[model samples]
Target: MTLITDTISRAAITDSPLLATLAERWSPRAYDADAVIADDTLTTILEAARWAPSASNSQPARYIVARRGTESFTKIHDALIGFNQTWADSASVLIANVVDTTENTNPWSVYDVGQAVAHLSIQAQHDGIHTHQMGGFDAAALAQAFGLTETQTVISVIALGVLGNIDGLSPELLARESAPRTRKTLDELLLVND
Candidate 1:
């Protein structure tokens, strides 16, 4: 797929050929401040996560989606700690990926949630929107702010928006944004081939 971005080449030059959606997908920290995701596009992205396979169809995945300039958005952004919330603020949407732990505390529930988010991110990439999932956040503060029950566990936050000018970012963040993306070699990851 043709990557829709106004920045440097961020696509992953994989060791082997892969789907365009998978290869071109990269988390972007800089987002267009004026960008507003269309309602239909936003719903389509969320739908991808909804259809992701869950353990025994338990459907433990849940989300707290917030658009920019809203109270919910402010709360979620404020919950992000020890990180660059300034860049995140420009994102069109912020999603709180959560798990329903009320019952059936199966270990796979967390895995399922991750898969759902992965699907969502890939879909976003295909749709020409950038997604950045962040782990450095205050879960307890977010849980309390959203009035989430004990059973609803917050896992991560996703920032979604159109790619913005690299000049908008600070020197350090710009360097990070432009750094070469790398991953563990396939051989290093495989334990057995038989």
Candidate 2:
């Protein structure tokens, strides 16, 4: 594992035995502004998402990627809500996950898109990339900026980059970043009803 991954892993709090990559994976608001991700690396991460399972192979998930310093990136960043915009602006790459809702209304397309995004996140973690998915963006604004049709629904925006100094973040975000991770118990999540 890379030093960044090691540090994140040491800070993670996991309840079960999980793959090292999974355990190390997290959403970091502080990103290395100077870091630039390679095209090949981004392609590999997307490839992982491509292989994720879909309902009857509908394969509705699509990604609109914008590298930092580009107009597209600025558009995506501008669509973000207040707090998210403050932190996500420093990410090296921004990706908007969308789903095609043209053909079928099965509602499973959203789930498929979620799986694809999860795959992308895991692949990124394996590659020592930090990713933070945000739901605080204006979907309509993003669609307008990207020329997405009504058939396309924007699901989420992902901020991708290397970890950066916590001091770069505002005091509130820094405190949240340093806070311990927590999750509900398995019993609370899984229940058998008679």
Candidate 3:
């Protein structure tokens, strides 16, 4: 996978090989303000999410997408907290990932939603779009703004767009954006039975 250095200095260097899209996929706070994703591209990304596996084929994951400059987008953006509000505005698309917890209320529903979002993010990366999933948002505020029912649980807010210059970011964020990516080794991650 080609190292991404336009918006950030560091790239995702893995211990072993990985899929190009997975290796290249890294969230950036700097998003191109003027770029708008095509409808077909957005559909393709969502289509990838739509096919994610769920418990009993429940398909509990749901998405509320708000393109840039719409009322929905503004509402979603306004719900961001702290540093997220500072950079998320430049993104071309904001999505609220939610899961239905009404009937089944299965513990695995959250995992299903996470899988769906992961699929969407990887697909976006393959299509040359960057995705940043944020947990620093007001879920209740978003739910109220989006008119989500009590049964729907907000999972995350995803910011999607092309990468942009880091000049506009705060010093702290700029440092974070350019920092080397690291992950736990397999030895640390895996638990072997005696």
The candidate scoring highest on TM-score is: 1
Worst 10 residues of 3 by lDDT: 1-10
lDDT for each residue of candidate 2 in 1-194, tens digit (9 for 90 to 100): 12232355544566777888888888888888999999999999999999999998889998999999999999999999999999998899999999997877676999999999999999998997889999999999999999999999899999999888776667798777766778788788888855
Q: What is the C-alpha local distance difference test score of candidate 3? A: 0.89
Off by over 4 Å in 2: 1-6, 9-11
What's model 2's TM-score?
0.93
Q: Best-fitting candidate, measured by lDDT?
A: 3
Worst 10 residues of 1 by lDDT: 1-10
Candidate 1 residue lDDT tens string, 66-121: 99999999999999975648689999999999999887788899899999999999
TM-score of every candidate: 0.95, 0.93, 0.94
- Against the hidden true structure, what lDDT does model 2 obtain? 0.87
Go through the candidates in order and give each one's C-alpha lDDT: 0.88, 0.87, 0.89
* lDDT by residue (tens digit), candidate 3, 1-194: 23345623444677888887888888899899999999999999999999989999889999999999999999999989978999999999999999988768877999999999999999999999999999999999988998889999789999999998787778798788877888888788779845
Q: What's the true lDDT of residue 71 in model 1? A: 100
Error of model 3, residue 63, in angstroms: 0.6
